[model samples]
Target: MYDVVIIGGGPAGQSAALFTSKGQLKTLLLDNEKGLTQRALIRNHYGADDVPGGELVAVGRKQAEKFGTEFNKANVTNVIKKDEGFTIETEEGDTYEGKQIILATGANSKLAETIGLNTKPSSEPYVKHVVDVDAAGRTNIEGIWAAGTAAGVSVHTIITSGDGAKVAVNLLSDLKGERYVDHDAL
Candidate 1:
């Protein structure tokens, strides 16, 4: 069992992994290389200057690894709340448990093409994923929170990363029973 498990490996997921692991929480990051940032050309992000999204993700992953974040190259099939924590099920039948789960799967890109229009379900099955968290990136599940695209904010890489940092601080505070750190502190 880990202290926390983050789903996805995009900017939000990476940011969460960094903070949690740095705070000494056993952390794991799961992604299947199909996150939203995978296709981003990303030339306008701050600190990135002109780097591509894929490169940024690579660097972030390396940094997280250096910080002791565990990486699981698997696709999560389902997440269920267990008695003590949460259980994550992967397509390969592997299971992981964590005291807290951050749903950072990022926004489902397929919805963009369907928005502002009405259509029937496709003859072929389609998956529609939504991140409906609020401004502060609070998830629908208790003891679980989210940020970045996973929280449904329209954000570039810079903004999303910032949100992830904020969520981490808040999460830490919740665990420590201390004052929540303001986003500016991050």
Candidate 2:
């Protein structure tokens, strides 16, 4: 089974995969390549002064792939909990097993409902039907997490990216059976 299966390709999912894969966890990121980030065109997204959203996605995915994170461009149709972990089924009729799942499907997406997680409407202005998550981006189900806009955070790429990193770190800590501090060098 893979260490983590991230269910989104947006900023949140990509950022999470970057961290998880860098942490040496076998990671798989599934996405159909159509998130709110596709429309992003700005200079306020941290490092870069100006860049298209698609460019960011491409660079982030490339970086994660360089770190050994697998990418699947398919629509995830269903997720089922198993004795070992979880099974993610895609519209392409493929299944992947993972020790953990992270939902980064963006705001108002109800992918969690298919997995029996209790989701609620977002209280944010004009935001609706966001997945319910705890402080650590945890869903009602164990081994499953919701991050970025999927967790009811703002739709901004910067905030969602940070949220994704935060959720990834928390999930990594849980998987290691102790607190995991990400250290780049010896």
Candidate 3:
């Protein structure tokens, strides 16, 4: 079983994997190529003068991979709550289990509802629906989280990426049984 299973492969999901795997948590990142990252042409993200959204996601995935996050190409069909944590089912009939799960499934994504997350009509004009999350991306169900636009944040690349990092840190801290500070020091 992995420490965390992250759904989605956009900025948010990649950012979560970067921190969780670096924090000593075994991570599995699953992607189905549905995210809008590939189509984004970004420039407003801090420190990123100009970059393609897909390139940013690629770099983040590589960075996470360097820290030992497992990457998989699969279409996830369901997240089932189990005693050992959660069982992730893929369209290919493969299943994985993890101690925790992060749903970074992006905006207008409906995967959260399958796992019984509390969802509401999205207040954002462009978003049709969003999972309800606390400040740290916790959904109504324990051991499950939703981040990025999937958790009802602005779909801007920067916001979604930062939200991913924030949610990752929180989940890592919970797993560590203490607060985890992934601080950069000179």
RMSD of each: 6.3, 1.5, 1.1
Could you give the candidate ranking by lDDT, starting with the highest? 3, 2, 1
Worst 10 residues of 3 by lDDT: 107-116
| lDDT (tens digit, per residue) of candidate 2 on 1-186 | 899999999999999999999999999999988886888885789897798898888888998999999998988988999998999999899999999999998864657777788888886676677888999999988899999988999888999999999999999888788887877676
Number of clashes found in candidate 3: 0
Clashing pairs in 1: none
lDDT of each: 0.72, 0.89, 0.89
C-alpha lDDT (0 to 100) for residue 7 of candidate 1: 79
**Backbone N/Cα/C clashes per model:** 0, 0, 0
Cα error, residue 45 of model 3, in Å, equals 1.0
lDDT of 1 by residue, 68-98 (tens): 9999898777777778888878887899998
How far off is residue 182 in model 2, in Å?
1.9
TM-score of every model?
0.82, 0.94, 0.96
Q: Could you give me the TM-score of model 1 versus the true structure?
A: 0.82
| Ranking, TM-score, top scorer first | 3, 2, 1
Clashing pairs in 2: none
